[model samples]
Each structure stands twice: as C-alpha cells, then as structure tokens.
Target: MLTIKSVSKSFDNLSVLDTIDLHVKKEEFVSIIGPSGCGKSTLLEIVTGLIAPSNGEIYFNEENVTGTTNKLGYMPQKDVLFPWRTVLENVIIPQEIMGIRKKDAEKKARQLVEKFGLSGFEEYYPSALSGGMKQRANFLRTVLTDKRLLALDEPFGKLDALTKREMLKWLTTVRMETKQSFLLITHDIDEAIFLSDRIYVMSSRPGRIVKEVHVKEKHPRSNGFLLSKSFSELKNELLSSLGV
Candidate 1:
C-alpha cells in the first residue's frame, strides 16, 4: 500500500539515491539489497519520512505522504530499546506517545508480549535480554504501533548466525499470521529470499534499482529450502545482480 516515485536524495551536492521508483503492495514483503554505499538506508529514511527527498513523492495507499512522519513504523538497525525501561514499558512507548491510555496500552502490550515470546520477561530490562530477545522486544514495540506497513532496516544485523536464522524462521511464521506489509533493508541475499516475495537489487553510489528478482517460493519456507537447488539459483541470481 506504499509507493515511491522517482525519489532522489542528496546532501550538499553529494547525491545518494537517484530517481528511485518502488512500491509495496498490501500485505506484501519487499526487500532492498545492494553494495554498502548504495544509500539503501537513506531510501528507507525517506520512505519513513525521517528525511525529505531532494525530489519526487511518496504515497501511502495513493495519498501523498511525502515529508511526513508517523506514516510508517520504522525499526532501525539497532534495537534502540531504552536500557532503563522494562520490556513491557518499552513496548508501550508508542502507544503512550500516541496518547493511548496507560491501562489500555498496557493491556495490549501484555498480549503482544506473550504473542511475541517475551512472556515472562515483561519486567526485564534490555540488559537482561539475549540478542534475539532484544530484537523481538524491539519488533514487538514496533508492531504495537499498529502501522500497516513496517520499514525494517537490518533488524537482524547484531544477532549470531544461528540466532539470525532462528529469527528469520520466526518472522516467516509471524508474517503468515499477521500478513503485514514489510519493506526490509538487508545485505543478506538469503535473508531477503527467505522472507521476501520480491527483492530489489540496487546500484552503488547514487543508488538506483538495477534488478528486481521475484522469489516464487511460497512460505512458510523451511530451513531445508536454504540448501535446495532453487535457493542456490536464487542466491546466484542475486549475486549476479550485485555483480559479485
């Protein structure tokens, strides 16, 4: 339900994104992957209205929401959970900001805490949680915002490989259950293919969409799919798209 048209960004003559055009359909999961300096995060910042583009428009469900905040739920690379706040407290921050009542917000947050596997950890602080737990708490906080589309910027970057794999599997289940639209920024080809319905490969420097690869594999995809011939082919295709 989100569309970006010819969006470009620049800072003091250093061009970043160049005439980018992309969209996420309702309940669709899409990913953007590219070289390190290709402005993937910048594109997301613009999408989330953290920063305005130098050019072009952003539309949410066909309404122009360019240069506006709160249109999309954003999860940056870091979990950014407050160190002092308990898990339940952190999850309710968005609701508090939105003027939701403390009693009602807490009630909702409690339900999601259980749903997201943070059940008994409600009173625990960020320091006490494992890396995966921290990420789940962070994601739960984002989900509590009740935004239809979520802009995720490498939320699994900090976890160990095995933990990351487990989180991905969990995310697939969550997607099946929630059917929320996701716009993910990830460097992992497998992560993108494992979770995304379509992947956008970007060019370096002034990032532009160079290739769009569609993953026909249906979810919930299993771990064994990672070793399959189709997965290998898809990985190779993405590698080729990145010119690796």
Candidate 2:
C-alpha cells in the first residue's frame, strides 16, 4: 500500500538516510528497529509527508504522495494531547481539522473510545487519565482520522515496561480486528517481534535497511508465544544484527 524508492535525507552535509527503498503491503504491520539516531523517525516523516525527502519518491496506494497528504495517520513519540480538551474532544480533533460536522465526528469518536476501553472516560481530561489511558486516547485520535496507513514513531516508548506490554497486546488486538497497515519505529526487540509481520533492522547512521526478519507467528499471539523457541531465535538474530 506504500512504496518508498531511493529515499534519502540529509541535514546540510550530513546524511541521515541513504537510498532507502521499501514497500509495505496492505494490512501488514512492519516494524523498523535500529540504534538511536539511525533516521528511523526521519524516514517515517518523509513517508508521511511531514518532511520532504532530500531525494527520491514516495507513493501511497499507487498515488505519489512525496509531500504532506491526508492518507496517513501519524502517532508520534508523545501523545501531545490538548490539555484543555476532553478525551472525546481529543479523539475527534482530526475530524474537526477536516471540517467534518461536529456531531458526526463526536459519534464516530464515541464509538472508537468505547471500543478501545475509554467509554466512561470520554468526559475526562488528559490530566485525569493514567499514562496508559492517555496513550489509548491518543491512539484513538490518530486512527479516527480514518487514514488507510498508520505511522507510529515510538508510540509506547514513554510507558513503563508493564504498561508498554499491555499497550502492545491491545495494539495487536486492534490490528487483528481492524486490519490496518502500520509502520512502527521502535527500539524494543521484543515489541517488534510480538507486533510485526516483518521487522526491518537498520544501520546506525545514514540508516539503510540492513536486514528484514519475518515473524511467522500467528495473529492474536499469546503470551506463551514469547516463550517459544522461534521468538528467542528471532530476538537473538536481531540482537546479533545490531551488534548487541
């Protein structure tokens, strides 16, 4: 559903991404993992049109979208929720931006919030919610844009280990139910393995795809899968690739 061809980005004379090429199929969840400052987030920005590529082209669902377009839903590192807005308001923010009727947007937002376990909390403000709940609200907000493609840049990086694991499980469940395409950037090996169909390992600087690992695990993956031989083997392989 998305194609990136010979994509590169640089700041002044220093290159961050070099000739990166990738294709993501519809409904596939792909994770990009690498060391810090590897340009994973840069590549995501270019793909989502938040920033222009220094060179090369990006296509979404067959149309060229090298620059900003409405076909993408981006969830950045922080939730960046509007403190003044209630959870329901936050979830429907995108719809407001798109000039959709408030009533219609609120209806859709309520359905999503309830579906994602934020039902009774719709009237709550950001400060009133826990970190996990806030992130859930953020997730709902991003997807409510109704974009066909999702780009997640370390969406759960700030959460504690237990909350992160819980969120990942919830995300996997949502993906299975919705069949949305996701391009996730993460440093956690276990998270990448548990949530992705294919994992792309990138180099340190001037990031490039060094390896692609396929996780053949089934959807709605169980906690038991984390203890399986295949999971350990794949995790070890990723560690080795990163020279850990």
What RMSD value applies to candidate 2?
A: 0.8
Write candidate 1's Cα lDDT for 1-244 as tens digits: 9999999999998999999999999999999999999999999999999999999999999999999999989999977899989988898999999999989999988877776889999999999999999999989888888999999999998889999999999999988887799999999999999999999999998999999999999889999999999999999999998999
Give per-candidate clash totals.
0, 0
Candidate 1 TM-score versus the reference? 0.99
Per-residue error (Å), model 2, residue 244: 0.9
Model 2 TM: 0.98
Q: Write down the RMSD of all candidates, one decimal each.
A: 0.7, 0.8
The whole-model lDDT of each prediction reads: 0.93, 0.91
- On TM-score, the candidate that comes out on top is 1
TM agreement with the true structure for every prediction: 0.99, 0.98
Query: Which ten residues in a row are the worst by lDDT in model 2?
Result: 108-117
Model 2, CA-based lDDT: 0.91
Which residue pairs show collisions in model 1?
Answer: none
User: Candidate 1: worst 10 consecutive residues by lDDT?
Assistant: 108-117
